[model samples]
Target: MRPRADAVLSEWFGPSDGRLLAVPMSLRGKVVGVLLALEGGPGLNVAMVQQLTYTVGLMLETLASRPNVPTPALTPPEVISGEPEVAVEAPPAVPEEAPRAVEEVSVAAVEAPPAVGDGSETVQLKMPIAPAPPAAVGRAPEDERKHEEARRFARLLVSEIRLYNEQAVQTGKLTRNIYSHLKEDIDRSREMYEQRVSAEVRADSNYFHDEMVRILADGDADALGV
Candidate 1:
């Protein structure tokens, strides 16, 4: 056998008796390496060449997809260039003071003499001190009832204001610039409500505030057609 330039990879592998097959190992249509197969029993055919080419291509593609290759992260590399970190120390605990001695309480029991003659020992009973009544007990029930009703009304007023404001905002008539003016109007409305309705409906300061918010919201909604 002689080395021939006309043959496939002749000079690289030297002269051989059997037929040689050179298949390209590729990934994504790019050639990565070459697969060399020497046919021992039979001559190389089209079916054998196709099978070998497909198997080698799949292996190369799998290897390329694996995490074996080292890749740079897309994010900016972190810099260790900064001031040296200082270790934080916890605060020292305070020493506890010595406990004071407790004074002993004395309880006296007295026995009373039997009044005529059956002769049974009678014991004198001592009554315990009663606790003082709560602060609410000092307030009249009628006033408390009125205050509760006022609080409930105030909460209702708040709900109404929220609904009206939502509608006003949707209509685009309410702007941030006139918020202070609206607030002033609300305050005026609350003062008027308090002066006129104080006798009819007993309420707290919060009740007047809620009423003011409601009045402003209603006025804005009416102007906006919302």
Candidate 2:
């Protein structure tokens, strides 16, 4: 019946422009939570609410699965302007006759120079090998996993949009007036994609737009008209 909260609330608690709706959010086959929406003005239609909750679940689950990225340390305002007040502890006083332990270098541990067995004998020093690039070696697998998850999530979101609006998508492609036909839907979907996809993934490539053009527009990007 009347699920919007404002209408029911206004009758007893005075006039209110607010609206409320809640839809179940499911990830895979499990219902994890509910999408609680509150608006001071107009509310989305039932179809939009359902579609939104579905995508919200997918996005939350995917994001939760990604490894946490460390945030950069920020300098405080006092540090920038001037040195902030800091307390320094004085080191404990040592005995006047405290003997400092000095480590003796073992000469035997060092390799001896090559003996001059032959007149043509020459010595070659081994240069220290440079360390491998940390980013390339250490982060390669993590980066690959991140990109894979990003691409998969993008594909899922675009596929759902295409699946739900199949008839409209087809008609829009034929008429080449997709913007007019589904401007609101496409705009909202793109907004969701932008919001859900991390900056790292976006910097690499916009897979959402790629899939949207490929699936919804039949590989003809111009068909979507943006």
Candidate 3:
């Protein structure tokens, strides 16, 4: 039976078929059903077969233990199958015509200008001048040093991540001839971590440089006093 199943799985390599090679379904650590696929190429390898068998077994065990409950038959079953099930909650409502407090501003009154020397009538116009915007505060010297350190660390981290990714790819190619989900997960985690670190570096970079400058300024001031 196993040999015939294997042969059938191998036959799945035919161009006409586009199905899975083999799917072994199990229940309670035992083979309850064998899903022999007749699509796709070259059939299942020993490892794939083993993994599939295990996965099937786990699923069957769960189903077997689950209490039998009459599930509501979905109306238009095809629609349910075509689209994934997801619940979206409505966003909170905002109040209309929100209350607002009024702000009062004071304006200085200007006196009229005196008549000109020729006794001709003079008109004086006063325009309110706006205050200058505050300058952006500079970072401290210690902050500057920290920024530099962070930049250096970030570079090192990126280099290490690339190196590790390359190593993982090479290792997968040599040992398994295919990259596994575990390797993909590791790569994803590393990428996310790097992004987070980069954000932190950008946010604090200016302050880091400022701190270094402050330290240097203090040293110079002390030297001048001496």
- TM-score leader: 2
How much does candidate 1 score in TM-score? 0.24
lDDT of 3: 0.35
Model 3's C-alpha root-mean-square deviation from the true structure amounts to: 35.6
Residue-level lDDT of model 1, residues 116-172, one tens digit each, is 322222323221111222345556787665554554444333333333343343343
lDDT of 2 by residue, 198-225 (tens): 7886887777777677657767789978
For each candidate in turn, the TM-score is 0.24, 0.38, 0.22
Q: Report model 3's TM-score to 2 decimal places.
A: 0.22
Q: Any idea what lDDT model 1 has?
A: 0.40
The positional error of residue 101 in candidate 3, measured at the CA in angstroms, is 65
Q: Any idea how many clashes model 3 has?
A: 19
lDDT of 3 at 31: 32
lDDT of 2 at 53: 49
Sliding window of 10 residues with minimal summed lDDT for model 1? 102-111
lDDT of 3 by residue, 139-194 (tens): 67655544544533333333233233444433543454322513454345446545
Off by over 4 Å in 1: 1-137, 167-181, 188-192, 195-205, 210-226
